[model samples]
Target: MSILVFVEQRDARVRSIVREVLGEASRLAAVLGGPVVGVCPAASDPGLATLGDAGAERVLLAAHEAFARYDAAGYTLAVVAAIEAVKPQVVLFGASAMGRDLAPRVAARLGVGLATDCTALAADGGRLTATRPVFAGKAIQKLAFPRVPALASLRPKVFAPAAASGRTATVEPLTVGFDPAAARAKVVRMAAAAGARVDLTEADVIVSGGRGLQDAGNFRLIEELAEALGAAVGASRAVVDAGWRPHSEQVGQTGKTVSPKLYVAVGISGAIQHLAGMSSSRCIVAINKDPEAPIFKVADYGVVGRFEEVVPALIEAVKQLNAQV
Candidate 1:
């Protein structure tokens, strides 16, 4: 009858999305009158003591050698085992690459319904409802679970992380055994992006550029502005299609969705696909030469001018502001 959160970690460090999921879960658990529990799969202890401050009363560690890297079959078996042992009424996962891949597999194994990419979650009268954008972000849909052990994946950066409570969670080891041959795929190695900045989905601020930049070489302007603001760099589908940026940095209906605290669109005309990904940002700033640009419709602030002239001024302004702070 507890809320179970899947704790995601990289290099023994917990992902920020886990804290976001845990924060929302804690709110739901308060209404459901249940405790919050964390389920983690790792080769060794990932230093999860801080989860208690994030609302986890207890942590379940499913230790296994295969868990060092993500193995679909191995992870599915491990998560299923944890669910079986705890029998939580609700289960939550971060809507990250790994979570998106693993949630469906776990749901299928349990034959339960799952809601993905939910931006809002609420509990009323002990019933949980999830809200997600649908129809290419043109509409919103609310979903309710008809069965126990309701499962859902939450979008990153949409919910604020829980404030520290100065509490420590009790860690317990969960025993799991799976056949090595059951894993059809194995991660041979991982290559980190060199000099990578904040992940787009997890960033608080984002600066995005589009085809209006005229050429791929102009992306350095976007990067420089992003650096000045300590933000992640994003690109529209057109830019990505032109091979100016990697698909990983693309923001659109076919790309990764984001809900950062601040979004700056430089030379972007505001395609619906691009809007679908970042419309949830708390603040939006659009800079374009044409006042009729579609992006201005949703922007909290708009500047009409060529980015070459406008961006440099904005970057200097930001630098001045940072220096004062």
Candidate 2:
């Protein structure tokens, strides 16, 4: 059987996470010597054909009025239909909020085992083995499912996105008799956050701040540095709780878990809950005045100085690096 990957989207646009999942799915398919298929719930997206570059041999798009907006129930139904059509041995999803909600429902409907938030995956002898964090990132658990198709959700940014191979793929339309009323939930309207920044989960670089920034006004330093690095802006729970930043920007256990290529923590004391969220980041840089801050312990590099002094210098350095490039 082949491998399948769910294509994630937002506001009539394909999300970067889709590429990440496809990259991983392609590798898993190689291990099993199987083909990779891409599945998406869209309202006639021409971009579906481009999935081939990421390693999909065929792309399936489920188009319907109910798909115009995201309703978990309708989406689940469409995905189930696609899964039944493909009959894949392994199905992969990027562990975004939507994927986290959809994977279990899809698994239950199909009567198969589902693994969530897998950081590592491997296919051995046509069997699937998944490594995931347990006890709030304190322990690791390896899971295997041999009897049925393996449904797994991968952590965002843990796997690098595969480059386009310039191969063309065939696009197929999936017919689903979608009923709008059948969906228990329907999104009426979608509003963006106050200021749109890079998507944290998909960003390669993120600059996160905490209460150490002193006040909301001081966050300018963080923003400036983010702009220099073309990074997303994130916050610790304390910053969110204090109303200095929105919950969307918060990066901690209670907020959003992000594993970017580079994570920069400014004036944030690392709490266990916060570490649980960003500990898997490929490279972590901590900047705080206190040398004893908890964030320094896990940081791949630490700066012992105030963010005000450090941020300006860092921003300038990034500018020079960009100019040289």
Segments of candidate 1 deviating more than 4 angstroms: 193-195
Per-residue lDDT of candidate 2, residues 1-325 (tens digit): 8998988777677777788888888888878877999888877674877888888899888887667666688778888888889988998988987899999999988888999999999988879999998765767899999557799999887876778999877888888877887666778775765226677877889999998989899999899999989999999999899988989898978777788889999999999999988898889999999999999999999999988899899999999999999
Highest lDDT: which candidate?
A: 1
TM-score of each model, in listed order: 0.96, 0.92
Residue 103 lDDT in model 2? 94
In angstroms, the error of model 1 at 20 is: 1.0
Per-residue CA lDDT of model 1 for 191-228, tens digit only, reads 88522558898888999999999999998889999999
Off by over 4 Å in 2: 193-195
Pairs with steric clashes in candidate 2 = none
Write down the lDDT of every candidate, Cα atoms only. 0.89, 0.86
